[model samples]
Target chain A: MVDSGRAPRRGRPPVSDEQRGRQRLDISRHAVRLFAEQGVAATSGEQIARAAGVSERTLWRCFPTKESCVEPLLTKMLDAFRTVLHAWPPGVGLIEHLRTAYQPVLDSSSGEDVEAVLAVVRMTHDEPALRAAYLVLRERAEETFTEVLAERMGMPPATFEVRVQAATMNAVLKVAADEFARETVGRGITPEVLKDHREQLAHALGLVTRRLSGTDVG
Target chain B: MVDSGRAPRRGRPPVSDEQRGRQRLDISRHAVRLFAEQGVAATSGEQIARAAGVSERTLWRCFPTKESCVEPLLTKMLDAFRTVLHAWPPGVGLIEHLRTAYQPVLDSSSGEDVEAVLAVVRMTHDEPALRAAYLVLRERAEETFTEVLAERMGMPPATFEVRVQAATMNAVLKVAADEFARETVGRGITPEVLKDHREQLAHALGLVTRRLSGTDVG
Candidate 1:
């Protein structure tokens, strides 16, 4: 068995990565619904666990704090942005590239997922815990932004200017997203409203990064 | 007594605003010191209370979370910036105004106060709890920034563009401050180093706000 290509598993087999991801998403969906229906302060871990059909122990293992239950959803949004940025072609304008590539992804994303994400974002306005979770995830994405921006600008990722640009870019995007989500939460997020948000984000990002060499073609 | 200049006093005499401010500052100093000596995770509320010569109840009343002990200092910094912005004259460049008016405030501030503030800012890098406190304070200050920028730009404060600029400005300042604090924490803060920080901040702010009519004269 030691010489075989596949090594013998120890004890019980661990949960597969896809299963873990699905579980997290399920819990995040339940947590977001609870948070939206009842305020984050009124929602508890047990309630969330019950709603998600998971035990308290499993919930705690998956997320350390009740506030952090939204991480998987937030991370998914950030990951999409990062993926789009990584695919951004050199010599193409950032806004144009995002409109071309990122817009389709947003259009294709399930309405339920988008609504959950918007609800979480909308809740961040009043809930400090949720806001912190959101900010921390956004902060983590800044490094990825810095690297991509640095490559495009021919500067080190750690350079003050490059880092500042990356941070400003993220801040503009975040503020725009927050504003859109806040305004669109009460009324349903129509395709028109979503398009408006995308335009607003692109416009803000373009204005902030206009001075950078590889960012603005306009 | 109601007709008289002095109204009838209720129950026990309340603590004076000055006294409350002093008490908060003292507790904050102690908390910052302990957090610096030992990591934030290792420091307890009781230890902070003891170090500050206050009861745990009082400490809790002053700061709900142990991480929020730094709010007093952070608010002081933001208040200074807000004051400077309010005093800023139209037609004057932002960076030049800061250099002329703000530099003196920094110069006159006690070294100990500066060190404590820097220590708190530096700690925000690795400590998620502390980082949350710091970010929340910074987020609050965005309103002041928005108001100032809006007045100068002749736009409504709540306008999306104005708000985005305000958020971006705060993000740039925060990133710069964190960087400066991280770099200067080990070596004692020097006047030269302080000036360098001011310049870096002004420069970064200028770069981000260059396109705005009221912010950049250059």
Candidate 2:
């Protein structure tokens, strides 16, 4: 039987997943700026579309609601961490991998992305929908951590130890990143400071992993 | 100079703090019942007063808004873990402390309080105000963890290691508790099974502490 799920051949080829994702993120960036400038309720779909240089129909096609506009940007921030973890080399200590591979993203010229992240954090403080979105992202990150952890330790993801370790690690990273974001906004702390935070996070994760696995990975 | 903040009394008041707290809790219990039955927006300060058998003015004096009526119940549930941690003995391991102290408060002979706690959880899913209040409680709980961890490790609360470790532990406890709540609602998991999640939590915390301190408590 033909797989109906597959994209149908048409005059214009379907947008690649990567292109669709970029368009979604483009809309999110515009939506965030609008949401930040005006309140979420005051912002209109047309305004976001205008800002993103896309048609209103295109914006709606990408996001069901204006509140959901934050998802792509938020998801990208989380995916950055997940990408690092996925690329982590086996037998290399967690701390070393984080310090060496993770620091460049924050320090690169793409500092505007860091500012976008801060806007989401500020929005979460007052916007319930955005806060819920942020929490959902966090839950997904925890699952990713659980999978990576289970693979590293040769255990099933459902194992109690793996779940607990994943939860602990998730909590640490979240709290640390939150504090870092706050500092970045309130005290003008640079992303470089986050390097030290990453090291501490790695140490915290290492401790939990060692205890759960009954072997030290550090 | 007389200290303005100091208590001005020849002797202590007739009602103890515990008695006052119980009285407030009673009012909160009735208010939550009305809120759950009639909905928060439909319920009013005057109606809550009548249900709790108190004056409307008294209800206002206690809580600023109708939504906050659930705070007392929500705070009590969140405080349960911290109260246990505060009473933890030095010789006991973290896991043992949790298992021994955590009883199924819902299964106790007092079934009314169980209903109140469940109502708060159910409301949290829909009520934005309640969700914000719930998050504030979580933040307080994390602070409590930080204090306990700092004391245990003989480090100042401002210490980087202490903060990171506390964050990880807080995350683990939150995820485990969240899972327990979800499971209890969806799968009819008993309190006994929920309590079993604590062992994994303790193991997670144990690993975090060992990694940070370079020594095992158990």
TM-score of each: 0.90, 0.70
DockQ of each: 0.65, 0.34
Candidate 2 segments exceeding 4 Å error: A5-16, A35-50, A53-68, A104-109, A122-132, A182-194, A211-218, B1-72, B90-92, B104-109, B115-137, B154-158, B182-191, B194-200, B211-218
What are the chain A TM-scores for all the models, listed individually?
0.86, 0.81
> lDDT for every model?
0.82, 0.71
Q: List the residue pairs that clash in candidate 1.
A: none
* Model 1 CA deviation exceeding 4 Å by range: A1-16, A104-108, A213-218, B1-13, B104-108, B213-218
Cα misplacement distance, residue B182 of candidate 2 (Å): 5.4
Best by lDDT: 1
- Candidate no. 1 TM-score: 0.90
Q: lDDT by residue for model 2 over B11-92, one digit each (tens)?
A: 6657888876776788889888887888776888899899888899988887766766777776677676777777777756
Candidate 2 CAPRI assessment class: acceptable
lDDT for B71 (candidate 2):
70
**Candidate 1's residue-wise lDDT over B70-160, tens digit each?**
9887788777778888898988887887877775236435668777888888778889888877888888899999998898877899999
Q: State the TM-score of candidate 2 restricted to chain B.
A: 0.76
